[model samples]
Target: MVHVVLTGFMATGKTEVGRRLARILACPFMDIDSLVEVAAGRTVAEIFANEGEPCSIPRTAAAWPRPGPSCASRPDRKRFSGGWGTPRAGRSWRTRTAHQIGLRASRRCSPSAHLRMPLPPMRSTLPSSASTTSSSACAGSWRDGDGVQVVEAEARVTAEGAVQEVEVGLGPRSYSIVIGAGLLPGVGTRLASLGLHGRAAVVTSERIGALYREPIVESLRAAGFHPTAVEFPDGEEHKNLAWLAVLYDRLLEAGLERRSLVVAVGGGVVTDLAGFAAATLLRGLPMALVPTTLVGQVDAAIGGKTGMNHVLGKNLIGAFHQPRVVIADVDVLRTLPRREFIAGLSETIKYGIIRDAALFRHLEERLSEVLELRRDLLVGLVAACCRHKATVVGDDEREEGGGRMVLNFGHTMGHALEALTDYRRFLHGEAVAIGMVAAARVSRALGRCGSETVGRLERLLKRAGLPTEIPGGMTPTALALAMQTDKKSVDGRIRFVCVEEIGRTSFVELTAQEIVNHL
Candidate 1:
């Protein structure tokens, strides 16, 4: 077994390159900075200021031995599932399985030299610094006197219109979220590569079915699987026990078996309903998602959270049934209604605020490009969101730890607004947009964050064409009541995910009335 470690200078895209390599290698991906943050219970910047950088070394080092999950049964070697999977664990750092890859940016490299850098072969050293002007040439590697090999590589963006993948590293249940243009037509071939065959159920709405059912079914058929398309009415209102029942009947009549694959192809509503169906039908089936909408691709379809909305709350009833794979075809997004597309940006913005300040800044800097549907930037945003979710989910798959709750940075009030409006006043993303504003305000009220932080968030939301204020006419009292029923509420107190800053969050518990006071 071999361990691959990505090390590089700041702004060199170590995290991004590591994510891509992990997806290609099919293994668990982790960052030293993230590990240190998790261990210290603080952000890297905070750690550096208070404890100094050297203090982080021990914390990061202690976490290096184990890659992921428990490996008690396999003492000799820790086997991973993805591209980075084959490394043996040891008692000491020197004897441990690790292949260091150092990333660097060259001043001479040009845009025309941009190309996807392939992974180096195991135990093989590449030229330390090949032709710097040639994008395809090796960036290089070197060995220390201690005999440890560290490969030096230059990270470059792939040419426009290339497929990228983000892996959700959950040990054996690990799966990849494929992002790119015109990917819908290749869904079958990808699924077949995963060793999934036999009966397959394609769950989607009639409207979505009319648009994509053919290509999906044809792809599955070409992959040698028996394909069946199950259609339902579209819209948030139809995501209920009734629709779930209807889905069950259609899948049953279609002769789906326990081992059959359930593929959902639509927006958040369809993903939630179909995922719930897949989770419960026949005691759960392997599922895949072809999320077409911006919201679906970034938030709904990636994580294993699948459920329909209850009359009282959004996602009130759901299970953590992960998908086997997710294919987010950017091309399908072209057909999305303008409002729907804009609404989807809410979740993407949430990701930036909660975990990735850089992503948030990128969105702020390139909002127009995103709005214009710049394929390259859009794909990067989607992939970045997926990476953040995958990291959080990997750490706390069941949300048993409060760690995963940060992902709900804006959902506390968002759900209430959705429930109060009866899912009519706003799209899911739009409501979340307002909820984020509310969360920011609450954070300031509680003194967890400053008005400046709130202002930056509000400004970004407004610039993105999202609602920053809750719609008038809905009493705060009524809104508070709706929030009381939220699943995150504890003993009638709403658990608000408050942003301490742009990319840092903490949970605060407040009663319904207390929440209204802040609002």
Candidate 2:
């Protein structure tokens, strides 16, 4: 299923366009900002005036992960279907048990997986007969005196399961990230709808290919495309110029051309190497991503940045090549090793720290469920991370401006540690866990954050079974030297991301001496 996501600066007609598009497609329309305003019991201008713009409504919207029934203060329990309702006095929006709404697909719709919108619409403008109630918020319908009822739309779930869609709005480069369980089998049918034809190259690691190759190849063959499987050794150590050269040789041997599609099906390592190859080989080839690991699904595969680690630093040699689509099958994550799964949490934690404080709280509250891979919680977590990533990537596709730099929350020391260890001692996420600690410490020392912030981060990382400190026998001096060669460094000064608080960060340049002082 395809979702049209409208995003831009304020007063950009995103809401109007979204409403019109929804009418044309006969789908539900949601305006997040309007929901925020209703929840706050104030207008957008008032919210901006009372609180800073940064603390305004959108942040509240980002916190919501799913749509459910909402409760209002009205005593009447009358339910209305497919129409507007009037608001009652002293009505306050609150969450209640979810009510099922069955929506039949229009003739224009195509058959595939069920499409669901995790976030439902909020209350809009009210009528004069109803008195305003104190500020409260909910996820579903809102009623007013003018016989206007605002009903939230729910996604259709089949006997199989439900599919959640997140839009990465890059204008012409935009694509949909489909997250759900058991999606790999239908990948072929989905690809066919995207206008892709000709041969397909599936780049994956030997380890992962052994488990998933047959299903993907079978799916492609069922969709009337010839798929060639290319396997490489699995490890960050193997992500180098030599392996890249090998992939190029393999693709050329397969008679791949510009019209052919490159399918990257593995963890972050495979995605980086394969995406880089697709970007450089034949100038560029259309690419699709199927990220298997938690790290890949939530972080690596969604962003357009693709590259292999350089001897000097991680991801130093790469290109900005966006994929045509990303299909994240949660079922595949069940095969991930425990350690790798824990490592992925580091990136998840990074997302919470950089933005989405509510996500951080959710992780803190549901760490056990997340670790156990509860389908409901895990799906929402993945969708939230993707939304955060899509927003950043849409704003800065190239990372030339500082907007995208916030994503490098912990990577300065993280990449340095990886290079210093020669990519052998620690997993990419492990090194990043340590790097985040170092960054938080620096932020505290520079008075950007309080000491409690550092402590909270250390405890969270530790709880996630991650290393929050430089490993024993590893010298800080070596890490500093490696950081000097980091891709983000300029004029020999290492640029660092400083955390002002959880969900708030800024970029700062620090000298080698100053970095050590924070440690």
Candidate 3:
């Protein structure tokens, strides 16, 4: 077998992604980290520090070179090569000049320089670059701040229009989050393919249901499902113990079972209540989350993690229950107000920060359409994010160690903010916006993150219509109390997840005051 190995500094999702790609390719995916751990009798961290890259890189490279056609004989063909970041101005100029000066240099010394520019902070888009040579057009996205994102979309003019699909794969349980203007017309039919049969419940808030209920209900009926629509009250205040009981009662009254399915159609609160109910009822039932808003589509629906909030804190009453499918209908976003759309962007930006730096770039270029809620782009944007979240979720399944926590890039202060606001003043995505700003500040305090990172995240938040700072009239004490009970933390230290640089992050334990001081 020709083994293809993936390498990066660390926590670049090599092991998790490699395994899944291997499965798709029908090949054995080996974990280099695990192998090194066993061989050197140490952890990846230990090996890097003790043996260093000078020794480790060669050892890793030595693991390659399977029996294949030698490069000497097949010099015309090339396998693969890719890289990241920028170069020192003078150094890059010299290399490019050298290539142009010598004819033989192109073969002997092929040089690619991705100059260091202020890229979109993890989660949004890179700024418009007239001079930047990205590996591919619309390569990635970067976060500007709170709800603000700079989405870069690449285009090359030609006779025939080319359609580049941005997508998300959740293994067999996967569904699409297409962001194109053409996606909304028949989403219910697309969802039915995953198996919504004679009976299905449409769980959403009354406010949201009022707007788009008819088409969805009709769609479900057309798909042969005995559709029943249930709309709870709107707002996070309703996402609590009392609301869940109502849903459970409604299901019972309808005589639903594990065989039947629950289709959550709305924002985060709707999905959380519906998903939690689906996870617990009959020891688990099939769920197809049709996230309407950006927040629901990008952040809430894809991840298996779901729960109603306790009076004490946000997401404290939750479970790690994977959905059978997540259909993020981007068309629903058109119905949303600008602020609501921005809230969704907040979560999308989170995906960029926690995972792909490239996603940030896409947002930068397409900021206008995204802000305008251009229906055409919604499906692709949502799908790209769904793929991002689904990939992490499939690998972790359960938040064991640091596997799933990466998804909580801004939730540390986010949850606390929601709790402090009584879950009414700010939407979940809005809270995340403020939370990310706070986290960036804390990162700066630790001497890890730079000022530019803070500015990028902050700007995105504003553009997305989210708050950058805590709301007025809230006590720092209540916020601190909320942080103490954050579900992701342990030993009551309020462990915050911080990104040292773009495309990388680390979990660090911090005190409530530490977070408060930044605020």
Candidate 4:
């Protein structure tokens, strides 16, 4: 039997743990680090030097061997499910029960494996509602009127960020997404600067109506355009065809012309619905995107893909409509919950993996600062991500080929997950996070990517408080059915975005069995 022989510095948690482990197993326990330290009090280095013994040792590709038996001997390798499944062997005998039963019996119980991550939690990224406050640390708790309970969130700044220009390329239909947080203060001024005219409307959602309506109305009036406010239902569940009509009817009622501007201020779903509405209304008007969720700032707000999901699939009804201006003010994120913020990071990390490899390096290097909401670091991170996404969108506005498909690196299964749950269980970014992990794993399994790359991606996603695999709610068969229902599926073949390596992704065809194997 393999037994773990702990080998580390003396001050490590070995001795206390050894005692407990020994007690549990009814076996002898040795604190080798303590024994080594006791034999060489001052320094093992000095003893090695005096004895003239070589410190360098043999190395192997595999893990270091135990001095005697291996750690494998201590316990059986348990195939444990996340918070939702059967209990398995753990570090301690009572660990499994202690972890799963530690919290309330509700669905909101934080997964033990999830919390053990070195990074933040998924629940922390989104707030319960729009009125949440910033905290001393990056993680902030939030509650909404509905009591949805996102826990922690980050509302990406709703203002134009650091970029000098907002690229709005559509060939005669092209416009710019201006970068600056205060662009909303003088919404008309910014729109007029872009050479827009007629009437202007602040298109918001019901949840954010109380907090953001009046200022926008006043801003449009100040800018010499007829200003009206339009608010839709709150939350991602209802971001669909029904809500798009509300904005359409309001724009028509306000007498908005082709030259008018539709200022969208809220979350990704809001921008998606409003952006698509503006695209269809008056044959596409100049619309300014003010993304309020972290998912919006770096990803959704800049991508120019707008639409609503169908019961059959996610984002099945969408248009490639570029916003005239995208304002990503960082200050707004303070109101978001910790979970929403972490969820948003999943997309930001996607940009890093697909385009700017340096972004991942920065994320890994400054994880603590990113979680802490360090303004300077976040500003730079947001800007860099925007630039990456903007460049990709600029190249392929309609998602014809390679450039646009890169965005789908993990979305194929992700959309399926969203469809399976009816978009209630996880946030968009959370789904993408799980999708990306599946992509990485599939990439490795299919010989397109390396195992280490998959491991790194999993570790990073977990650190960002994202899920690395499909949660227990969806069974393998159900997951297969959902994937089959994906809109991107062609000729009954489900396509997966497989990674060849870091920063390289490709669309690959797979059978339902292959996809099920991935889960």
lDDT of 1 by residue, 287-339 (tens): 99999899999989987998878887888899989999999987788899899
Error of 2 at 495 (Å): 2.4
What residue runs in model 4 are displaced by over 4 Å at the alpha carbon?
1-170, 180-183
The lDDT of each candidate is 0.76, 0.74, 0.63, 0.64
lDDT of 2 by residue, 411-503 (tens): 888888888888999998999999999999989888999988788888889998999888787676776788778877788887678999989
Q: Point out the higher-scoring one by lDDT: 1 or 4.
A: 1
What are the per-residue Cα lDDT tens digits for candidate 3 across 272-372? 99999988988987887777778886778776779888888877788866666565555567778777887778888877776777777677567777787
The global Cα lDDT (0 to 1) of model 4 is: 0.64
Worst-scoring 10-residue span by lDDT in model 1 = 78-87
Q: Which candidate's lDDT is highest? A: 1
Candidate 4 on 116-200: residue-level lDDT in tens? 3232122221222111212111112223342223232223311112223446465775665544344457666776777776678
Off by over 4 Å in 1: 1-161
Q: What is the TM-score of each candidate against the true structure?
A: 0.71, 0.71, 0.66, 0.66
How many residue pairs clash in model 4?
A: 37
Candidate 1 residue 326 C-alpha distance from true site, Å: 0.8
**Candidates in order: C-alpha RMSD to true structure:** 12.5, 14.6, 16.3, 20.2
Could you tell which candidate, 3 or 4, scores higher by TM-score? 4
Worst lDDT run of 10 residues, candidate 3, spans 99-108
Q: What order do candidates take by lDDT, descending?
A: 1, 2, 4, 3
Q: Which candidate model has the greater TM-score, 1 or 3? A: 1
